[model samples]
Target: MNGILSMPGRSAESLVDVPHTLEPPARSTLPPSAQRSLKALRLSAGFWFLIALVGQWLFAWYIAMVYARPVLSGTPEAINNTAKITGYIVGDGLGNSLLISHVLAGGLISMLGLLQLWPWLRRRVPGLHRWNGRLFLALGMLGALSGLYLTWIRGSRLSDLGAIGISINGILILIAAVLAWVHARNRNLGQHRQWAIRAFLLVNGVWMFRLGLTAWLLLNQGPNGNTAKLDGPFDLAWSVGCYLVPIALAELYFRAESSRSPTRQWLSAGALGASSLLMALGVFGAWLMLWRPHL
Candidate 1:
């Protein structure tokens, strides 16, 4: 981030975009049949994105139903929606809209994840890639802004310390998004890649929240004790842990990739692989124990 540090933060025009030409993948020059098969296997360009987006849209649809039904029908009971915790949250048309927007947009943000992670797509379709990158940054900023308002002003039931953690979470997300844009503009792909990954993980911090909190509930034999609702210092701890740990892990991965040591690379690969598996397990844990039941 020395490059980022040296660049003036005050001016949006400070970063000069030095166009860098990246070499096209060898797979692109392969025989037509071979290249075609790669797409079928989702190894070529961005074809797998269709599969990923389908899953995300389905998830979004479910969330839309979960939250929207209560608000639309003017249902007095909280029903399956967590937003129904306090009647006041959904009482105002503003809070109701924000909750619905946040839930619906969550899956779309996951779609942006597909773009940032896939390098081939950007090479194949630079125009679409540039447009979507801008869209991703815009929506990401909006999501964080609205989330802060909903969490703090509109009352998300977070404890004072938990709320502070959440506020910091939003700020980090916003900062990461801005930094990604700056680096990308400067053609600093190295810095851009790292900052983009950071932003991606930070954007998905809520998933960590669900996964961590749900696992705690399961281990403690239901939502008994401080785990029941967001109470005590546990929420505060988990709120920060969810994002902070991932950010630390991202930095570790960046450093290992930059290093020349094969041993370090191997260790970093193993650790990241294990972390991905754990994250998948956490998703399942949350789905089985929390969100699915709400449906």
Candidate 2:
């Protein structure tokens, strides 16, 4: 597989791992205007990752304090009172185990994934990156499976539409996970990294859903198009958009980075910057309103 997929003369890792590498074109070949556009796009992407890293770490911390702590302290039932989702069952040991595993695995994955994408880590600590990437793919598959079981077999969703949305997200996660592994096994690191990114976004659909929902609620001064069942128009759209929008933005970033056209690069940078700003707003709202109160 490696021989078939890898380039004959290329032994170095993919450029995807080292976006800020002092490569030849970046240092000398590209025109000043194109270089500037590339730099802006890189900056915007860095800003987005910075925001995501902080927000997701905070969320992981929140999960640790609110969800994992209680389970560890031998009072798992307490989670029922604290969790925003229907996370605990009073008597069902199997269900409770799955719930705890899903939540904790999610928190760990969110924390670990940011490190996997760090340019310094991948460039300098290649072994750690490879090991961590393996662990991430495994956990991602497990998380997706557990989530699907909870939403469908366990009937944890608020509405049938919401369940359908969750199912789609789970399926995407599985597909991304498989493709990422295949690419990695084939030594196609560039495609592997892209699929890994898609997997990360899909795996965090629930997290993004919370952030997007809180942002919308704050912007509207209330849950204007929301209901107790979460089957409203905005909720339905948001369930899909939470993951899709970020993936679309990532695709734009990839295209812009590869394109020599300064206009396309600048436009992609603008789109990414705008989306990052909105994500920042969402993170802020989620931190203040949802996660903070629980913590």
Candidate 3:
């Protein structure tokens, strides 16, 4: 009887010792399915981000292409010829400088923004990422300030509202970017990641806004005569939707870090997947509209 009792204790001791005897698997030993799933998720996010980045670049390119000749030509006739019938001008020299700065900054931001989507670039080249981020922030600030200054000079109500909306978003982006850098300096990586994500989303606001416009026009079968008129209702709707959606998505991702429940995981994954899809649709749709022209 004593031997039997001792045997149970011995067995328990042996079980505890067994774990100690074996080495924990290195990261290389992570299950294949888990690794693959991680890879898939990253690839999906990268793919969607690239789509958004490219779409934004193309739009910027189109704007530059349309305005470059006129702005660079520096002739009175060219200066007076606005991109749109209702477009506003900021006189000659200042307007030309603003236009040139806007296009160049936009192009650089779009290109650098694409590189930031890659995980390796973010992790391995953090110094480069940080420098680029600073440049982007500075340019974004310049763009926003310039945009606000030009908003008062916009010819149409819709254009004015668009400028204001973009300016507000640009400010938000700058704030987020600043916060991200601050958090990173303090070593609060979670907050840094969240703020960085928010900044990136704000940077993509133009893409989202353009898509919203195209959808509105398409659903209406064509633009109404007063479509260029910025009504409070349209401006409010666009501002709320574009700003809230991505922030909400980023929050969902942040929350997923602490959640262990399968349901929460499902919800997080669903939100991420949905956001990725929306981003892709917005990007591709905008590209088709801008580039194809007939669409």
Runs of candidate 3 with Cα error greater than 4 angstroms are 1-44, 68-82, 85-90, 153-164, 219-226, 232-235, 291-295
By descending lDDT, how would the candidates be arranged? 2, 1, 3
- Over the stretch 1-295, how does candidate 3's per-residue lDDT look in tens digits? 1221234433211211011122223325556644444333334444445556557667666655555555566542452343443342456567556656755666666666655444445666788877876777677667655555555554323555545666678678768878977887887765666676677777667657767656555555666432445444665567546876777866665554333333554566566676666666656666666545521
* TM-score of model 2 (CA atoms): 0.91
Scanning candidate 2 in windows of ten residues, the lowest lDDT window is 15-24
Global CA lDDT computed for model 2: 0.81
Off by over 4 Å in 1: 1-61, 68-80, 84-91, 218-225
Q: Residue 188, candidate 1: how far off, in angstroms?
A: 1.7
In the range 1-295, model 1's lDDT, one tens digit per residue, is 1222244542211121212332223445656654443222222112222333333444455565666566568772454345434333435788767656765567567556556554545666788777777877777777888889887787775465666776788899899999999999998887787777678768777767777776666667666435445655667787888888878866665554444444554565555555555555555566676566677
How would you encode candidate 2's per-residue C-alpha lDDT over 1-295 as one tens digit per residue?
1221234753222323433322225525898998888777777776777778778888999989988899889988878876556778778888888889998999899789877776656767799999999898899899999998888888788899866776899999999999999988998777887888899899888899988998899889998889878889899988899899989988887777877888988998899888878889899998998888887
- lDDT of candidate 3 at residue 29, scale 0 to 100: 52
Per-residue lDDT for 85 in model 2? Answer: 61
* lDDT, each prediction: 0.60, 0.81, 0.57
Q: Kindly indicate the candidate among 2 and 3 with the higher lDDT.
A: 2
Backbone-clash count (model 3): 0
Which whole-number lDDT from 0 to 100 does residue 132 have in model 3? 74
